[model samples]
Target: MTPLDQKINTHFPGLVVRKDLVRTVKGNAIVPSYVLEYLLGQYCATSDEATIQTGIETVKEILRKHYVHRNEAGLVRSNIKEKGRYKVIDKISVALNEKADVYEAEFSNLGIKRVLVDSGTVKTH
Candidate 1:
C-alpha cells in the first residue's frame, strides 16, 4: 500500500474500501470508477471482510433495483412509449444533422435510433 493508503487506513480503518469492492459490485453497470467507488464508500468502506461482503450485497441490490442494463433498455423505452415516462440508466449519444437541419439521438443500449431532438441540446451528454 502507498503511504497515503496506509495513513488513511490507520486513521480511518472503516472509511477506506478495498479496490476490488468496486469491481465486485460493478457487473454490467458500465459506470466510471469514481461513481462505483463513491457507492462503495457509502456502504463497504471497511476492512472487515464480513461487513464488506454485506456491503457488497447491499450495493448489488441497490444497483439491481436501480441500474438499467443495455439489453433491457428496450423494455424501458417501451414503458415510456406506452406510459409517457420511465426511468432507465443508459449511455446515449446525440449528433447534429446539419444537412437535415435537425438533431439525432441514438440510445446505444436501447438500440433506438433516429430520435429527433432539439438543436439546442448538448452533444453526447
Candidate 2:
C-alpha cells in the first residue's frame, strides 16, 4: 500500500479508498471526480493490496458495462447488423423536420453529428 492508501485507511478507515483504484476505474464515464471517488470509496475502501486490486477490477467492469462512450456507436451498430440483435444502453435524440421532410438524429454520448435519418425508422436510446 502507498502512503496515501495507508493514511486514508489509518485516518478514515472505511470512508475512503486507495488512490490507485480511482485512477484505474476512470475511463469514459464522464462523471465528476467526486462521484468517481465516492464510488471508489464504496467499492475499494481498503489498504490491503489484494482487496484494492479486486475493487479496481469490479469498478472497471461496472464502467465498461454501463458507461456510455462516444466512440462505440459504430461497434454497436455493426454488432446488431452481424448478429441480428444486440443489447445497447444509450441516450438518443431525434427531431422531425417537417420542412425538410427528414429526421435529424443526435446521439448525446456517441458523438454523432446531425445524421439525416429516414422517417419513422427507429427511435432508440
Candidate 3:
C-alpha cells in the first residue's frame, strides 16, 4: 500500500474524499478545483499509496489534456461528439425550488444557463 493510501485508510475511514490531495493536481483550467478533485477521487481512492499516486497523475494528465476553457465550448462539444464520451470539469451548483421536482445545471463562466443534468452526474465530496 502507498503511504498516502495507508494514511487515508487508517485515519479517514469514513471520508470518501481527500480534498487536500487536490492541490497536487496541476492544471490551468478555470473550473473549480472540486470538479477535478471529484474525478480524481473516483480513480485514486485506493488502499495503496503508490497506486493512488499513479492514479492521481493519470487523472491530472486527463485534465491537462482534455479540459476546455470557457470560451472553447464549441471545440469541447465537437470533441465530445467525436469521442462519444468525455469527462469535463465545470463549476456546477445545485438548486432546489419549492416543489423540488426538477434539477438544473448552472455552468459557471460558460454562460450556459439552466441546462438539465442527470442526477447520476452529481457526486458526493
Candidate 4:
C-alpha cells in the first residue's frame, strides 16, 4: 500500500475499498458497482493484504448466500415463504399503489413485485 492509501485507511477504516478489489469480488454478477463497494467497505476496507484477501472470501460467501439472481427468483421466493422472512440483496423499487392504497415494492432482479411496504420505509428511501 502507498503512503496515501495507508493514511486513508488509518483515517477512515471500514469505509474505503480498493478499486481493483471491487472487480475481484464482483465476478460477473449483474449488480451495481455501489453494492460491491459497500460490501467491500464493510469487510475489506484495510491496507493489510492478508486481511483484505480474507475479507474478499467472506464477501464472496455473503454474496453467494444473500445476493439474488434473476434465474433463481423462484427458489429465493420459496425460501422466503418457507422461512417466513429472508434478507436478500437485490434492486428494489417502491411506489404507491393508489388502487390498493398501499406502498408496494418490486425487487427488479429477483422478479418479485407488489410486496407491501411500510410508509416509513417508502418515505425514507
| Superior by TM-score: candidate 1 or candidate 2 | 1
> What TM-score does prediction 2 earn?
0.44
For model 3, how does the per-residue alpha-carbon lDDT over 1-125 read when each residue is reduced to its tens digit?
A: 46776786677543445665676664444546766666766777666678778878788777766666777877777777899876676666766443756667776644556766556665442
Ranking the candidates on lDDT from highest down gives: 4, 1, 2, 3
Residue 71, model 3: lDDT of 78
Cα lDDT, model 1, residue 122:
66
Lowest-scoring 10 consecutive residues by lDDT in candidate 1?
Answer: 116-125
Give lDDT tens digits, candidate 2, residues 1-125: 57875776789866875555566666555745665676688777876768877877876776676545667767766666898865544556888877987888876765655779876575433
**TM-score to true structure, per model:** 0.56, 0.44, 0.52, 0.92
Evaluate all candidate structures by whole-model CA lDDT and list the values in order. 0.72, 0.68, 0.66, 0.89
Model 1's alpha-carbon lDDT is: 0.72
Per-residue lDDT over 1-125 for candidate 1, one digit per residue giving the tens place of the 0 to 100 score: 46776678679855676777777777666766775676688787655678778988887776665556677676777787998876554556888888998888887667888889876566424
Better of 2 and 4 by lDDT: 4
Would you list the clashing residue pairs of candidate 4? none
Model 4, range 1-125, lDDT digits (tens) per residue? 78998999999989988899888877787768898999999999987789889999998898899999889999999999999999899988998999989999999878988999999987777
lDDT value, candidate 3, whole model: 0.66
Stretches of candidate 4 exceeding 4 Å from the true structure: none
Report clash pairs, candidate 1. Answer: none
TM-score quality measure for candidate 3: 0.52
- What are the RMSD figures for all models against the true structure? 5.1, 8.2, 5.4, 1.3
lDDT of 2: 0.68
> Of 3 and 4, which scores higher on lDDT?
4
